[model samples]
Target chain A: MEAFTQHTGKIVPLDRANVDTDQIIPKQFLKRVERTGFGQYLFYNWRFDTQGNPDPDFELNQEKYADGSILLSGANFGCGSSREHAPWALLDYGFRVVIAPSFADIFYNNCFKNGILPIRLPEETVNTLFQRVAQEITHTLTVDLEANKMEDHNGFSAEFKVEPYRRYCLLNGLDDIAVTLQKADKISSYEKNLPSYYQVQEKQNL
Target chain B: MKPRTLFEKVWDRHVIDQEEGKPATLYIDLHLVHEVTSPQAFEGLRLNGRKVRRPDLTVATMDHNVPTTNRNLPITDETSAKQMNTLAKNCKEFGIRLYDLDDPGQGIVHVIGPELGLTLPGKTIVCGDSHTSTHGAFGALAFGIGTSEVEHVLATQCLQQLKPQTMEVHVKGTLSPGVTAKDVILAIISEIGTDGATGTVIEYTGEAIRNMSMEERMTVCNMSIEAGARAGMVAPDETTFRYLENRTFVPKGEAFEQAKQLWRQLQTDEGASYDKRVVLDASNIAPQVTWGTSPGMGSAVTDRVPDPDSFQSDAERKSARRALEYMGLKPGTPMSEIPVDRVFIGSCTNSRLEDLRMAAQVVKHRKVAPGVRAMVVPGSQEVKKQAEAEGLHEIFLHAGFEWRESGCSMCLAMNDDVLSEGERCASTSNRNFEGRQGRGGRTHLVSPMMAAAAAVHGHFVDIRNWTFKD
Candidate 1:
């Protein structure tokens, strides 16, 4: 995972609410064994027509949103499915930060694991950002995760909250697997003295 | 001892480490893996030169991308077949036990977990799929995880996690005859919006939940994620113990009795505090059907299609209008009048034997409607075998329904058994999200009986007064 102390990028506004992972990186593209290469198929159905041409009518297809690294989406973004492919695609597509009114629990945790910052501003604030981005010639925001704040070059600024542990992991690019293995003794002890009921014997007979 | 909730008790038992400014490091007792979300996790392990931390604790099966029609024929889809092969190779390399496609034990991950007696009371379980909440019915603390956490668990068998706030859904009174567990849960999701349970784990209690069968309890817990809940649980009782007893993998005789005593203690302590409480009158619940995309758009069968203008919020109204447009449905029409092109009755949600029997009872000696193509795909090979032994498959076949082998057929439509674009289906699956069944496919979520009844009528029908042709 890449450390995320700060990122300043253009905001691409997606105005729909309840944007599920099924739409983020549809299930069809989930077949690849490796996590990379999903960015090409991100929002496949929404982004392309039946003939494989990118639909110009789609929000992200418009020129203004192209090459934008910051995604400002609707409430409950990445709602359905626990596939981390949704975050993998978002990260692979060059999105460093995702700002929404809210996000699904699994998706939020996934974004942090992939180093894509998911920030939850109030719904009203998100609406204002969407409006401001639409009106501005080129709207960019700098998110200082270390300072727990987001700001635009103009006059907009707001404080955000991420749990201390999650923030620490993101700021330091910590691998959770290594951090958990440090307490290997605790896990082994619990398994060694397990009750008879908790014992899971080998199922060689099956 | 201070009274503790069922969740707190489970959480406390699993916590190996908790430090200031850090979440607890909780041990995972059971890790269920499947084809779709796990390949990347396994690849991560190989790249890091890591072996599975606990092969004994891990289980694997193929479900999401399996075909329901073909038994021996090689999978025709190149991508799906390769993905399935990847899982088999990874499981063998990692020393994890896998229930192959030909194995009788093979089934949907959630179904096989409980069927094999692996999903036990008071255990902390996880899978790389959202509906892992389905295992919570056994009084276990089960939730879905992302592939990264899947890889983390595979490498360390532990996850750093926070204690989510708890919510109690208390449903009292008896469920009506046609009102099944599916109906009860749909009604609850309707009461609370899709995101209502966000950031919380829901504990379903009261007479309605207590009186349900193990299969029915699973049906209720399976859709917790649809309401944005992290997990759903029901405290273990005699009903729960009876379901696991004598099953494979559970302790035997004297050991089982001793286990029973501890399992009994998994209940929420009397006078335990809860963060929030929402009560439902189970007797009032009717057969449910989702008219729109999200499961939260569900309504009683007798209700009319809601006008988008009826919604109070700006977002909701707009969403409703788009849903109606995408679903190709007209507002103000009675639900029973809505016609469906197909009827599918199987998913992790309602594909157990009990659900099959419930559907068979409605379609017995009757015929499917002329225009409706109805299919019954059992959830597991074990379920398929059991349904065959009881002639449930015959009841479905005699009714013009297609009886097929076990797999996750058309639930998410990852297999060949998918609906064509613009086709409408009365399905027993959980989500009705746009393109969930397939692109441009419209699904109306229903109970087994409701789905069977709809198949005969060629449209959605109110099952409360449905009369069997037989």
Candidate 2:
């Protein structure tokens, strides 16, 4: 995971609501043991043809949005599947931020764990961002986690909400395992005194 | 002070640690693992040089990609075999309990969890699969988590979660015969679109939910994730206790009575307030079927496909239009008249023995419609054995349906059991997303009985009017 303060990048407008995780990354590409190479398979069904050639009509493949590091999407982004692959693929694909009207709970939590910031703006505000980004390839927005603010250089700006703890974790590049390990002593103490069935045994019969 | 909801009662008791600004650290009682989403989490633990903190609480099994046929032979698919091999190796090295392919208890993670008595009332359960909500039928606060959280739980035996607000769905009126829990859940999804219960855990109550059998309660809780709520629950009652009475893993003797005493308290306090409320008249809900790519885009079997123009928002109208196109359905077409090329009557959603019996009763003396391929895949080996004892498999096989081994098959079309491009299927599985059954495939969601009826009729039909042949 990487620390986040602020990021400014060209916006990619995905004009679809309830964009589920399966559409973000299909099931076929989840076979690999490693997580790094999933970016190539992101949106595999929509981004590629049967011949494995990139489809230019897809929003991400369009020349103007090719280098986008920020996504301005419709409401209820990442609505299905609890796969962390959705966030891993987005991060691998050069997306540092996802701005939507709202997000599914598991998907939203996963974004923070993977260091990809997900900002929930009002539906109208998100619609305005999409419209502005659609007008030109160079339209960009800046997300400042420290300030809880998003701004476009053209004077459009809005505020977002993030919990203080999640903000602190993201600002410091703190992964959950590392934070949870802080209570290792307490965890060990609790495990030491568990009952018979709760303890692991050697060569136990079923 | 207001009375607390059942969710708050269970959640508050599990809070082991709470910091002023951070999410609460709630201890977990059980963690269910499967082949697909767990490989990476095990690998992460290996890379970090960490061991499972509580191996006793963790259980692993092979599902998701296992073939429904050829259980006696080796797993033929390279990717599927590799995933299963990795899980077996990891479980052995970590000393976690595993129910491999040949194990009688081996089945879908959600199915085995309940049947083996690992799922109990007042426990906090977590799994890497979304259908973990299936265990919430026993009054457990079970929900799905991502693989990263899976690793976190494996290492610490606890999770940091922000509490979700509660939503209560009250279903009044007696359900008509042939109307099942599948109809109730599908109707709920249709009433409230996909994201209606976002960030909330739903508690189903009232006469309709109370009268359901344990298996039927599991069926209703199973698809809660389809509504974007990761957790759904029904409070423990006499029905729940009866189901767990003599199960292998449940407490026995005096321990059982003590457990029951505590479980009796695991209900909502009278006058409890919820963050949101929904009311449904279960009697009015008919046998339902999804018409489009989403579970929410469903209607009663007797209704016609909805026109996109009927929607107010552009987003809704555009989504409807795209769904209709992908589903190969015309706007005015009757749902029952929609033809099917295949019928799948299995999944974590509806693959219990009771579910199998429902389908068998419909297909006893009837033959599958010509050119319609149908199959009945049981949820687990235990479910299969029970079905076999009741002669349900013979009924299905004699009626021209394939009686296959137990595992997830054609639900997401991850294995050889898949619908080819442009094929339409009547499926009992949750989710009708594009390519869910295969690339360019279309699915109509139905119950086990409706799926059997569809196989015989070669299309979606109202089970209320369906008649078995002499």
Candidate 3:
């Protein structure tokens, strides 16, 4: 995971609510064994037409939001499925920050595990951002993890909240597996004294 | 002396390590794996050169990508065949047992867990699929995890989890005769918006819940993620133990008796409190059918399509309008008047033997309506075998419904059972998201009986009004 401290990027507004993981990356594209290369398939159904041509109607297809790194959307973004592929697709498609009023629990956690920063603001605040993005010719916001602040040049500034541990991990670019293995001794000890009733298999030792 | 909820009791017993500010590392009792999500995790483990900590605790199966038509035929889809083979190789290399496509116990991960008695009370379970909460029906702490966490659990037999708050949903009163567990869960999701229970674990209680069979309880707990809860649980009781008795994974003889004595105490304390409380009158919850793309958007089967203006918030109204447009529905049209192109009677949510029995009773000697294609894909091979032994397959086939082999067939449409574009389906699956069944496919989530009724009438119907000939 890349450390995320500060970045200023253009915004892409979806202007929709309850945008689910299926829409993020459909099940048809989930057959690949490797995680990378999902970017091309991100929002596959919505981004392309029945003929496999790029749909001009989708916001991401428009020239203005093309290559935008920050995703601005309505409330309840990433609402269905526990697929980490949602974040993988978003990050692979070059989205570093996603701002919504709220997010589904598993999707939010998956974003942190990957390098995508999911920011939740008040619904009113999100509405204001949407309006400003529509009005401005170019809207780019800078997200500073160390300061816990988000601000744009044209009088748009706000603070966000992330759990302390998560914030630290993002700032340090820490691999979760490495950090977790620090307490391997404790895991072994716990397993040794596990209650007999806790065994899940036929063999007791395993 | 604290009066702990069933969730807290389970959590306190699983913690292997914890810190004030960091997530606690909790031991995982069971880790269910499937082809679609496990390949990348296995690759990650290989890249890191780490071995599975406890392969015995983990199990794998080939679903989501297997051809549901025939186990003998070769999988024609190149990518899907590669993925299934990948899971098989990984399981064999990692020393984990996999219920291969030909295995009798092979099926949906959530379905096989309970039927085989692997989903015991008071254990922590994790899987790569969102419906893993189905195991929580046995008083277990089960929630879905991402592939990264899957790799993490495989390496340590533990996951670093943040403790979630608790909610108690009381379903008071008795369910009407025609109503089913799918209706109860759909009603709950509609009452609480999709994100209503985010960051919380719900403990279902009250008279109606206690009255539900183990299959029905699993049905309720399976859709907890639809309402944005991490997991849903029911306190273990005689019903839970009875379901477990004599199963393959459950203890035998005196050990079973001792385990039963411990499992009986896995309920919430009398004076325990919850972070939130929701109460629903089961008697009033009629058969539910989702009209929109989201599970939370639905009304009774007899109600008309909802108006966007009637929605509470601006976001809600906007979503409602978009859902109406995509679903090709008008505000004043009755739900019963909407035509369905397909009817699906199987998924992890409602594909058990009981669900099949209910649908068989409704469809016996009655043909599927003209212009509607109906199919029943049993949840597991065991479910299919049992259904056939009871002649349920004959009833469905006689009624013009296609009887198919097990795997997650049309529920996800990952296999060959996809619906054509703009086709509307009455299905028993948990999700109604856009393109979930297939590209441009519109799914109306309903119960087995409701779906059977829809197949007969070619449109949604109030099951309460229909009289069964049998």
User: B1-470, model 1: which lDDT tens digit per residue?
Assistant: 99999999999999988998799999999999999999989988888888899888888999999888766998899999999999999888888888989999999888988998999999999999999999999999999999999999999989999989999999999998888999999999999978889999899999999999999999999999998999999999999988998887788899899888988999899999889889999989999999998999999999999999999988889899989999999999899999989999999999999999999999998889998999998989999999999999999999999998888888888888888889999999999988888888999999999999999989888788977655
User: What is the C-alpha lDDT profile of model 2 across B1-470, one tens digit per residue?
Assistant: 56888899989878777888789988888898988888889998989998898888898888788888878998788988898888889999999888888888789898998998889998899998888989999999999999989999998898989989899988998899899999999999899778888899999999999999999999999988888886999999999999999886788888899889989999999999999899999989999999988889999999999999999898899889989998888998999899999999999999999999999999989899999999998999999999999999999999999998888888877778988889999999998988888888899999999999999999888999877664
Candidate 1 vs candidate 2, DockQ winner? 1
lDDT of 1 at A26: 75
- Among all windows of 10 consecutive residues in model 2 chain B, the one with the lowest summed lDDT is B461-470
DockQ of each: 0.67, 0.56, 0.57
Quote the positional error of residue B341 for candidate 3 in Å: 1.1
Per-residue error for B6 in candidate 1, Å, reads: 0.5
Every prediction: chain A TM-score: 0.95, 0.92, 0.93
For each candidate in turn, give its C-alpha RMSD to the true structure in angstroms: 1.3, 1.6, 1.7
What value does the lDDT take at residue B276 in candidate 2? Answer: 89
Model 1 misplacement above 4 A: A196-203
- Candidate 3: what lDDT? 0.91
lDDT of 3 by residue, B1-470 (tens): 99999999999999988899998889898899999888889998899899988887888888788887867888899999999889989988988878889888899999999988889999899999889999999999999999989988998888888899999989999999999889999999999989889999999999999999999999999999999999999999999988999987888889999888888889899899999999999999999999999999989988999999998888889999999998999998999999999999998999999999999999988999999999999999999999999999999999999998888888888888998899999999999999999998999999999999999999999999988988
| TM-score against truth, every candidate | 0.98, 0.98, 0.98
The digit string of per-residue lDDT tens for model 2 on A83-202 reads 888999999999999999989888999899889999999999887777777675338888899999988888789999998888988999987887788977766665564334333332
The alpha-carbon interface RMSD of model 2 comes to 2.0
